[model samples]
Target: MVVPVPPPPLLASHVAVRAAASAISHGRRVLLNGDHPPQVAALGRGDWVKLICGASFEDAADVRNLSLVYTLAGVDCIDCAADASVVGAVNEGIEVAASIVPTVQRPWLMISVNDDCRDLHFRKAEFDPDDCPLDCSKPCEKVCPADAISLKHSMVDGERTLSDPLRGKYEGGVITERCYGCGRCLPVCPYDRIRAVSYVRDPTMTAELLKRDDVDAIEIHTTGKGTDMFNTLWDNLSGSINNVKLVAVSLPDIGESTVDLMNTIYTIMEPHFKGYNLWQLDGRPMSGDIGRGATRETVSFAAHVASMSERPPGFYQLAGGTNSYTVDYLKKAGLFQSSNWNSGTATSEMASSHQALIGGIAYGGYARKIVGRVLRKIPEQFGRVHIEDHPDHLLEALQEAMSLVGPVKGYIPSHSKPFMKQVDRQ
Candidate 1:
């Protein structure tokens, strides 16, 4: 069987071990071994009589990377050579119990990922020359995030070289560099983008595996180059960066003081983000549990669908809660570049719901307050104060819905919110 190991850098090389091959055509050889029967001449091909019994075919050209198309437990069954030339804890012996056919491609089967590839996890960030000292080479310096590595100076052609500063020299203890071992430079670099090189399943490798002809199945192994390997693929399958519309605003609908204050904020701040932001989707009619809104569920569903379709999907999370944490999640979800969001709901939804998310009414109130604040601060009042009503399209639709609700409309509280509530004693 062919074992395809991760191709390590030049420093460390990986090798494939061949497994053994057993099982010969027992019934056919013994019973009809003597008969050099006809080779299906009637089927129409050339004149070649063939042995009806099976053959324990062994050809060097037929073997290469071995992979288990299917699996029962942690054990695997791959298509390699007659030798145990593969990786895994399976017995070092080969055994072909029945119906052995010689072919190039292995059958396509599902293989469980157990101790499949541990070498990759630890080797995620590897360097050449394990014994290489942290001299001025700065091999990992440019990649450090915390700027933790302090450096000393070394001169070239009479000028002090800053690019490759020697880290804490042993001084007369190992006498090397010229400058006083100043640790200042290291602590100053932000090193925000520092990290080990990342890897993904090689597309060419996949194409090659899919080309297998002997076995009916195909299996691939990864050294876990990323956090969510599966998600990394699917979430990024579609174009990574999705361009959509978004905005920020505040609305009033939750009622119970929250509504009143929110509306007040809209009346005040709506002008700030108005006419600019796109409507957020995860909004409107605050309900039980944020997930109760169809938008929330829909967003999650989109994520799943992306996975199935081998593509990435967009998101509509609110922005006020936006900080390092949310950004990190978005980045991990591969949605950072695809998400569309604004600050408030009232203004955004009021403007448009064209693929947007709406969250808290408090957010809308805040947006309204922003509008009021911005307009109030502007130097001009009349002709200069051009309020854009484009954002109100969704609100307008809701308004028409209310008018059509008829008798049931009286029971339904206005979405605009002078929010009255059912008096539950609880």
Candidate 2:
């Protein structure tokens, strides 16, 4: 019989150790340049990456772990819901990550609030499962990316019951905390029982959060219908506006009126805007957790905005449909780090401060979905699943996050990058 050779282990412990070191070194080098605030520098370099913890996602345990993982992977900003508890969770995660890699640069903590209730990011999906027909398929449950919906049924004596077809008394409905209100379940529900409940964040509460020392940034979601709502919210937060380093406005693509609306909003914020401003071009909001096609809308929106000569003054970033494929899509559009946007007619604006045409991409649903896979593998017996407690899991999660962030940062697979590879000897 011929001798057989054993394959090397999938991930050696030493590789992880080296990767961690590289992450710290690269993070500091990319983030600590003194030309501007690290995040501002990243925007100017067209490498800024923000991990968006959804404006409505409030699961603290998951948020904490996700924050820790991404912080290690070298994100410039971490955008999350405006809730105090959520903000605390993000900070906790960042602190824990720093403990692991002492040199890891801490990402700016951002809180998201909405001016208009009409914005989809501020809504929640809700319904009563009892209203459904017994024979009806639970399509909503299948479609939900967050796994927020649950249904159970039990069989009766020698027969099936409609009321309890799920193996119990039809005990199923949207889990409030887990639902990020993507609205995917709405169209799939055959009964049309799902309803999206929208609400605006309290400006008073948002201002208070902004005042906190831990919060570094704030993003205002608007419907682009008019600037009256934007003006009102801006005035409400004006007193505390100086507390944060950056103020971001999240808006949708409103066609020809986008630039005009942006200019109007910019004029309103110009006097009061104390720090850097970013325009989040929200394309097909909350659909990133779906699949590849979902990223198209946001990239297309970026292209359209990039082509405009008079696009307002602010760092332009992509949101809404951002996912793994977003970077590739952006490169194809000639907008990824290409400063020649509308060179023939591109009039200088506030964005001229940034070197790149597109500042960066914000990963929301897709970012969570990628890391949530690793998070789910942790055994559930706990008060809270601190990812650091499980070293192996933490390493795996960091790799997943790095895969998404590395491309934009121009991180190559040498020993200097976060993911360490085996060295060959002559």
The best candidate by lDDT is: 2
Q: Estimate, for each residue in 1-426, the C-alpha lDDT of model 1 and write its tens digit.
A: 999543222111000000011111111112112221111110011111111000011112111101110110001123221111121111111111111112111211211111122322111232232233435354344433212233345356676545544432211111111111122222433432222222333433333333333222212222223324433322332231112112222121222333233233234333332222211122221121122232333233223333332111111223121211222333345543241333223332222222222111111112212223333343453433321111122122222222211111122322232111121112
List the candidate 1 regions with Cα displacement exceeding 4 Å.
1-76, 79-125, 130-197, 214-426
RMSD of each: 30.5, 8.1
| Native RMSD of candidate 1 (Å) | 30.5
TM-score of candidate 2 on Cα atoms, chains taken together: 0.87
Residue 376 lDDT (model 2)? 84
Expressed as tens digits, the lDDT of each residue in 38-80 for candidate 2 is 7877777788899998899988888899998898888999999
lDDT of each: 0.23, 0.80
Quality of model 1 by C-alpha lDDT: 0.23
